[model samples]
Target chain A: MTLTPTPDAAASVLAWHDVSVSIGRTAILDRLTLAVPAGGLLTLVGPSGCGKTTLLSIAAGLLKPGAGRVETRARRIALMFQDSRLLPWRRARDNAAFGLRCQGMPRRQRLDAAQRLLESLGLAPEDGDKFPHQLSGGMRQRVALARALAIEPDLLLLDEPFNALDSVLRRDLQDLVRQTVTARGVAAVFVTHDLTEAIRVCDRLVVMAGPPGRVAFSTGFAQPADARDDAAVLAGLQALWREPAVAEALGATPGRRRVTA
Target chain B: MTMATTAWIGRVTAAFLWRGWAVLVSLCLLAALWQVGHEVYGGLVLPSPMDTLRALGALVAEGVALPAALETARDALMGFGLAAVAGVLIGAAAGLSVTVGRLLEPLVRFFLGVPAIAWVVLALIWFAGSGLAAVFTVVVTTLPVVIIGAMQGARTLDGEVLDMARAFRAPLGVRIVDIYVPHILSYVFPALATAMGLSWKLAVMAEVLGGTAGIGEGLSLARVNIDTADAMAWILLALIMLLSLEGLVMDPLRRRLEPWRATRGQAARERRS
Candidate 1:
């Protein structure tokens, strides 16, 4: 479902207009204008070092843009890293509840909330009691997702959250994220280098190229949800690669066939 | 006990036995060396390990060493407590502030380079033979180490984790207490262990130089009387004290704080026990 936010700037869950960022005398992001409406997933996909992460950080309000403005109509925001980033000392339930714990929620209340969230995300009670080290990679990612969702965030920023996961786990978590976005109406921007993954989980896909990263192409996920199988996505990707900037960003010629992991 | 509990206990016992072999072997080697030294140097200089233990027993029997041990223990504890508090606070401040860290780095180096004896001498003059002088010496020698530990901890905090906390809008107090403090302790514990060992040695050294009680002062008295056996006994007692402090206190504290790093399966058992 596409929710085009009202023209009023205040209505958008997140909006970044003409944002530029530089680090240590090196420009990292050019003028970048992007917005994520309430309950939409906008994925930014590009080659490595294309400043996708920098842009996501700007959207997440972690890094200030050197040029232009970022705005959000969110009271709560959550960011998930590529790594689970679960506190090692805490068990899964506690790790999930950490954000709430930081917000000064009562222990019993937050733990109960987190446990329920974990259950909803397919974690068993025993799994929730185990420490992060004891959990499998997929389980850890699930717990991290539970942690982010526990805040009931209005805007969520995920930095290649699925990149480290195996294929089965990746698809499962991608579906979980899609379901979460729809169920909670959380605005999200997922940054990744994997085009197939970007197309799979996102409602819209953005291609960026960079010395200082800027969007080169933007398009909605065209296939119907059921037809978005691997073959369909890969077939549509050939036409996308024909655009000069897209070809360059993808490091592929128009005639060349590619399948990115 | 349940089967699982019994199996866990057995695993723990087996684990201890595994580590015990290395300890037993090391002790035997050291004992062999010590016995050889006693035979070579005779009783005047190098007493047998058994003779040193006998001398230690005699000192306790005469009521000469127990009070001294207590005094030294008190000094070490007080000095260590003072060092830990000051070191963590100052180190954290320096770690958090580049200017503060830069300004203090030179002084830390200067203090670190100075010999412990020099500090003991200065402390005696400053405090005029009080227990404070003894403690001051221990603090002077021990504080720099823990400070370095804390500074490194502060500098090396994972930026990603902090960013996650920030995005969650964690309160300032929560960030400081939970995220910052726990992260800082990863570096602080090892430094703290080093500081603990230094405190006891420095306390005794300071007491020997300036005070009228404690193991150091007693050591001086033994030296004056040319009672090498008693001096050796006091040395043995100090070693025992240091070993016991690490075994009974520091190791347990570390395990409690960082159970995750312990044996993965046994961690729960250790925590429960």
Candidate 2:
């Protein structure tokens, strides 16, 4: 079955067609089909070991699918991991400029570009000189985000990048990611287990489940991400839990339990 | 200068002076102990520190000390440089592949098991009376240490970081230079330092046995002539050379290469503040 999130094929930046992955004797992903339209924020929410990360890795072209194809119209694809994964020896600016450096950009130009990105992400100029260990958790994530953006990627893949941060910091980074994606017109596939967070940031949501992981449920939110207040997010979460497939995929108890004594 | 730069300069000066003072006090205590030993054993066995210094001065005045010291330094440094380059390259290759690592692990252990004295004896036989004997012994003894360090560094490189690099589509050259080299150097440096000290000792030992024209040769001559003061002087010269090299060269190079590690405590303090 084809699961095209957006109708226009030409307008999509990434399309995973019948993607399947297996490790040794165990199946991880089973003929999963998903798509992300240009300038869209899509969240893949699922329980642990549900192949959400596997799907993202496949999207990033880090891993090959066992059977099926991943097609992307993106000129450059960048991935951000759960941990900041910044080089400890490199200063924040150097870490942010790492992708550009990999592309053979001259040091001065890449550093200037990184400096501008850092500033936009709410870092002081001096913060660029600080090593990864010296930066706070949020600041390090900002550097990682800047690194992803440094290559001017058309498609961005995030694997729970704010998982380690506190709630407030996580929310701030979520907003930052959302704003950056919208501003840059980049297609992003965000993988997380947090439903409330998934509801708050995504234009479209995908819930996956099973050892042979496949999409259990998917929906598009009518409300704009920026306009979704706390109450709206809570309401969305409550409504999502009401769906038996979503509740099962997330390993949460169904909202209405039929109590027959 | 800015206030911060001034403060930094003041701190560095103070640290240097303080370290120099401490070294002076320790040397004085050593000298005092040597004097006591001289008084007990007399001039035939152990010379007084002053007598040794006087003998060293005489050797310097006669233009014998500097050339012999330089000869020894050249041999030791040559072996150390060769071993450092070869060990790091071979070890990094082995570390990157499990099959190669397993194959080389037993070989490294075997080399390590063979004593430095054994290598000196073997080198003496192979190279005859040439200075190559001393150089060969130093390389054989020191190579194992550097190899182990480089191998460990390469083996322990962070997998997540490698994944991140791949996600960025880093080329092979970039991965090796920016990722592998720095991580490997962290492990290789301490090993290099250890190997350097070992190289000097092994070179001198080989020289003494092979009768090369170096500090070790001078010591051998002193032993044959029963000149305890001369022997003590040569030993003192060797110690001074080693200490100077370590202080003036190695430490500064290490700090320059790994500024992040050198300033870790300061970074922590800043974060706390």
Candidate 3:
């Protein structure tokens, strides 16, 4: 039977009900239930072993939960990874057009769009022509970000993509992503180790922590996302950190290899 | 020309000279050993190096050598090309499916374990004095090695890279062509070099055993007439063909096709350790 989603499905961008996952004997996420509204910016912040990435993976359909279901109304979704993961053989412009290319867009048109996207991302024409190995780490990351946004997804999944960048690039990426996704009214689920970045970017913050990771708590700022620069938002962010799970999540030195749920 | 290109040429020549010198020394050592063997065994049992060189020159002069050498070279080329195409296609299929790979592993091992002589016996019976028998032997023996190589190449593919391609919604055709083909190429090129040399040797063996009109047939005819130098001449012709094919054809092709592997010397070094 075919089940077609109508426009009314926009009530939520994504939802997980009793979702559980395990790798070997170690359970990653156990009976986790959560939902994010359409056009929402939700960030998952948690301790290293907590299943923040696992949850993100499940949401992206990269991994399936051992038990329970995941539902999403997002017509188009894109995931931007930590590493640029560009095809080494391809140039930066070609890499940025990768998603469009996958969708079978004509090469010339996609390349033109990719060129514009790269220019907007502050990459020069020459830089766009360069290969991934030739580009700087920050530049490669931006190309990755551009690749995701170039698809114009209704939902964007980010997994600590700006972790390796300097504070400036990180801030710049945060602002760019927020502006792009928010302006498009695209819902984005971001998983990060940086509590402050999470606090600033997300409309809602969810904390996950434990041996069998579950959503420990969730909260929102009384102020709007635009007023994030204001001191009141910082105080609101500080107040949330006082929560035991939020503090624990912030203190975690996440497993360099993988996060255990 | 630009100074950078001059510097690049200088570096290439320096590398060439270094390697060429070692090759020269190795050839000298081989020649010295040949001379020692002649001294111990006499000219009848082990011909003098000069006598062998003279016989080789005479054979080239006689004009039987060139046509025979050409025939053997053709057989090896055909066999190696066939093995490459079949191996990659079959190996890719095996790599894509675990059950198929598991089933293929034992078959590949068994074929590899069996000597080329046994296959020649079977081929001789099946094809009966045809060039097909010689080519078949070369293809059968060389095919398994390349298949194993290609399968290993495909199997070791980075899962994360595969994940990235999948998440980006890359079509099945795109994934295989863009991701699998390039990754497998790093393994296949090195295997092709080995297969080329092996196919030449096997094809010659099959020719000798089956009485084909090639280098091996010349060697057999020389053996019957007790012409040791003629046999040695045929051996030299075969060696030249093998080395020329590898150095002139395969190496240039590898350099042209696989720039990624050439550029990633540091990563390869790290892997070696």
Candidate 4:
């Protein structure tokens, strides 16, 4: 009954099948279906308050879907919250190693694993000894990311992981996340409000529509040319934004502003 | 070199003198009123502040007074320590589990609501004029406050933090130490300080009633001998010692706990992740 992952098993890591979620008397997600490919970065993007967070919560198993089913390859799933939820009392390294420690790993070994993962993620060797309050906003998020990464989860869910950072730091963290998860070949579902940021990091994009979230748009990163800054990508983005159903569901126009896709 | 050092010394002395003068002025006003009362009622009924101070100094120089005060202090410290440990453990258990909390909370409320004097009488009868009676009363007076305080600390723990702990698959020990302990320590220590004060007050009161060897015994002896000045003198010495001990023990502990307040404060303000 151990929670450790059996290695090299990635196919259909997590799936949400006809899942609908409700909070209190109100329905938030309406019959939505999504799947994460093994070692794939699946980004969920939508306008504000459009059940993106709810879907992420359900996927992380923090919130149970009101109806339908959620299946996953591994029972152990870790979610990195939007705000770095590092325990202020614990040092950066202890917080990082928290999940492994929970798995009943021995102290020195847990510390070693946590240290290695954190160092790989650009954390200084000494940084793990500092408490969360002593760390800045960026550093705390990095610690949180390290904690999630240390668990070596088969499935990782992130809720707007870079929402609070300045643009440069956000880009750096985005790159860091991509590099770390890709190296480990872990399945990740990253939720973001930005289109370009999603495009930059995620292999595929799944966009949720409205309050009772439905899959309004789904696309893969199959652009032959460099679509990040290309005129065609911008035009296609605009066209997607102008889709009558998308515009109606989300009140904001899909304006062509450079954002973390 | 001499001039500058002299100037610095003079400034420091002047600041000290100003603070001393303020305290001296208040003391003089109190003394003058006390003198007026002694003038009206005469020596036996109401003693002047100067007479009480002189009596206190004489009692201390006699050497027996210090040992008596120390014994009383030792008893108070022991009683407070017992109350604190019992209260926090019970409170944390009650606060963490709803079934335990609901079952035990009403009993605590009943004990807290019962008047202090009632417990003193009951403890005196139960322990039969022994030092245990006084200590028992002190515990009764202080335990409920500390228990309620620890319970409040436990209830205020952030649910989101617990969820984070769960997601990380933290063991029970880790959850309690890194998560629960830091959150509860701030609330527990301040309540402990207050309880220490309460225990001391109850200890003295119980001694006066139960009549054992302590400051309270001395106070009762003063009353029996009809020496009003000596009684007031013992009361004043007891107050000074209680204040001193609180500053000595609890103040440093509170200073160590200061950093935790900031984190708990932030947790209170945060509504969601």
Candidate 5:
């Protein structure tokens, strides 16, 4: 493993230096180099087989690349999956406090922090006392987001966390996540298949492709995520679809059909 | 205590009492059935519930009941405690590894297939009139049940939740306590309750055959004397003890340990009510 030093290595919260992974004969991620700038929301958009979730797992240090190194300045990293994955036996507050509990924070302090985070994420205070089964899908996801945020992580890895929700709920959670990440100044790498969703929330977007996944195209949105309305996102999506490399990487037929948000 | 806590305690007490009342009603129904049987079959064949109670009272007055009950309780509980601890440790080890599980499965099945009576007979030969015979029979008969429960619990643990725990970097100790133990207990508790009931039955049976001084021995003596009421009294005593242990101890302990499961639908119903 070699670390190709970058000028902004100090500014970036996390950097993957020529990271490659293989499972048996199949190459999952091939020499994929990427970085998330401090406090930036970077979205990875791609087709199904492109190893987007694999990238997040590597980012979270849950999986090691077959070659190369993942370097992160962040002391604490939190990953949120598509499913809530909250412990059913624990109440919402306790679930939210899980990361803190793992870190050996005192019970009272962690619970209080979790309670505050849950409330900030639009969950009612009383909702924290309810178990995962008792909460609505949207509410459970909110608790999950609280769990991710409660650890005060420097880097956040999200794997299509809002995918299972309805479109409206998805949009709301997207806004909540973007706001939280920006407000906390935590760098985040979000993996999503939905190009429009990516355009809706990200500061910088990278399009990935192939069984041996590699970045095909990447761009930065000058307009802030908070400023991007549906029209702005749709326009951005159309513009991205027009990029030959992105359109090909995403396996979409270019100029044949209009893109819809 | 706060008013809310006091109110919560009151509600719980009320629920407990309501359940106790239902149990009492069932017991009364059983007693009525016994009275009908006694009237039809006469004194030699079946004793009335009242007569059986009187005989039980007489046994207590003669100081024969309490000591025998205590002796049987000690032997049964000792075996159960050993089996529970060993089963959980061994079963968890087996469940965690495919090779270990495969190796132990048939051995456990063989042990389970052997009838409790057979174990009792073996224990009689091996222990030769020692109280260890009863304890040995109880453990051999009940260990398989607890082991299977724990194995199933460990084997069926949710992989996704475990992944979540790993991603969060939960420590090994935390993972065991928060994830493994609670998850396993859900599967193991029912098995334990079953084993607990079996332990008492096997203990008494072993005591009867092995000639140990316990409720089983008391029943044997009554049988030899041909006093049907005395035998019925001993049987009644054993049933009451088992029921009380289940109602007052095991069930309550399960509810306490698994409050999340205990309150699942009941919480909603309680809110509605």
Candidate 6:
């Protein structure tokens, strides 16, 4: 979860050292070096095909980097993909406890933990026994979240996990993720294209450039911890939007101001 | 007593009986045509429906058909069970490994293309009028279909669900039983059901061609006697046995394994009020 060190010092849980990945002779991630501080929420933001997903894939051990090493102190890791990916055959609670059940946990224990998580996420007790098709889209995503959390993972990776939800539901889920991950103290790396979601949920932001993805920019929140409004966060985001390198990399007009404060 | 309620009941009953009536009427028309053709021909070239039914009833009364029918059922079940096991294993392997799929593709296609007569002749040579002829016919006719279904199921599985399983480091057992099995089963069951029917038909052909004792043997004997009505009667009996066997074995098992298909029967009460 949260690792707070003395002022000006930070701890690291997951790190990548000069990682590069190639697919069919084409480089996808090139010299992508990143260090995620223990218990900090680091958000990766970039345009499509910019290797944000690739970077997360390598970190989760789903893909091996061709040229570099990834170090992870967290033995338990959970990844949430963009599609929610609920198994249509399994009931919601069984889906939620998938990892644990896969880990050979006792059925009763897994069921109990799954039930608790479903309850925490506002799913009815009976709803846990219903199949995925019976649940709405928002409910499916919530079940996916519950599945990941049931493992009690020390590290969580999310790839645009809330993209399918409407704006209000998205905001509500963002708040839920914020509160849940903080309470659990899990280190999370969230990938998103939404600038506002990045500002709201991420403690730090890393942007990547394309073709052979490289870290293009890194920034901290401009607003103090007390201010979480759209206006204050939008000010910092607007500044990043104006960066000539960011604009050039993103293929937008190099120095245009779209938001005024 | 409300007229509207009575009319509503009448309409519902009519809707249900319409399809049943259509099926019954078609069967009656077919029998009439067969009877007229036999009368016009004035020979055993085609048997009249009454003649065939009388012959079938006499065969059953004399207990001449029970043993053959029982033997045929046994062979069908054995062949079908073997095919299901082999099909699922090969199908899963093909689905999981591209290399396996590539290597087996030609073999699957070849087996699928192999004529039923060719297989029957080969099986006759190998098993020589034993139960294996029937079993081999069933396997040869059905395995490829199940394998194809399994491969398709595996290919089309959602990538995200797979990634989730991998992220958790799911073991082989969990991966198959949970993630892969359910996904593939929806494909496998229908294929297996259809295959079971094919297995019975092919088994009978194998028995007939291979000179094995069973319903097919009885049909062959009727042919030898030049008893056209008896042959037709035996064929009808075989058809009835096949349908009843599928209803008794395959249908119940499928309904149990795939309860969602019977949603109206069990889950109707659970619908949101």
Go through the candidates in order and give each one's C-alpha lDDT: 0.84, 0.89, 0.83, 0.79, 0.89, 0.82
- In candidate 6, stretches whose alpha carbon ends up further than 4 angstroms from where it belongs are A1-9, A222-227, A243-245, A255-257, B1-55, B125-132, B151-160, B224-229, B259-273
* TM-scores, one per candidate: 0.86, 0.93, 0.77, 0.75, 0.93, 0.82
Error of 5 at B51 (Å): 1.1
Task: Please provide, for model 5 over A1-261, each residue's C-alpha lDDT reduced to its tens digit, 9 standing for 90 to 100.
Answer: 111122333588888999989999999999988878888798999988788999888888788899999988999999999999998889999999999999999999999999998999999889999888778789999998889888888899999999889999999999998898778888899999999899888888888988689988888876778888988887888788767888889887744556632
Residues A1-261 of candidate 3: C-alpha lDDT, one tens digit per residue: 111112222378899989888999998888988887788688888767778778778877789899999998887788888888888767889899989999999999999999999999889888887777777788998899889988888889999889889998888888887787667788999999666788778777777777588877787665656557835545656576555565665553434312222
Which pairs of residues collide in candidate 1?
none
> Roughly what TM-score does model 4 have, to 2 decimal places?
0.75
- Minimum summed lDDT over a 10-residue window in model 4 chain B is located at B264-273
CA shift of B241, model 4, Å: 5.4
Residue A59 in candidate 3, Cα distance off native in Å: 3.3
For A17-46, candidate 1 gives per-residue lDDT tens digits of: 988888888888878787776667888889
Error of 2 at B34 (Å): 3.6
- Chain B TM, per prediction: 0.90, 0.95, 0.90, 0.81, 0.95, 0.80
lDDT of 4 at A250: 47
Better of 1 and 5 by TM-score: 5
Clashing pairs in 3: A28-A261
For model 3, report DockQ.
0.30
Candidates 2 and 6, the one with greater DockQ: 2
Query: iRMS of each prediction in angstroms?
Result: 2.7, 1.3, 3.5, 4.1, 1.9, 2.7
User: Compared to the true structure, candidate 2 yields what TM-score?
Assistant: 0.93
C-alpha positional error of residue A174 in candidate 5 after TM-score superposition, expressed in Å: 1.1
Q: In Å, what is the interface RMSD of model 2?
A: 1.3
lDDT tens digits by residue: candidate 2, A149-217: 999999999999999999999999999999988888888999998988898888888888886899898
Clashing pairs in 5: none
CAPRI-style class, candidate 3: acceptable
- Ranking of all predicted structures according to lDDT, beginning with the best and ending with the worst: 2, 5, 1, 3, 6, 4
Instruction: For residues A1-261, write the lDDT of model 6, one tens digit per residue.
Output: 111222311577788889999999999988888888788688888888888898889988899999999998988888988888887778899999998988899999999999999999988888998888677778888999999999999999999999998999898888788777778888889999777788788777777788689888776664432346766566666776766666666667534545432
lDDT of 4 by residue, B1-273 (tens): 699899999988997799679978997898799899999999899998889988888889998578878878877888898999999999898888899889989999999999988988998889984668878887888899999989988988989888888777677998887789988877788889889888888888888888877889889999999999899889988988987786666766675665534456466554343
Candidate 3: C-alpha lDDT: 0.83
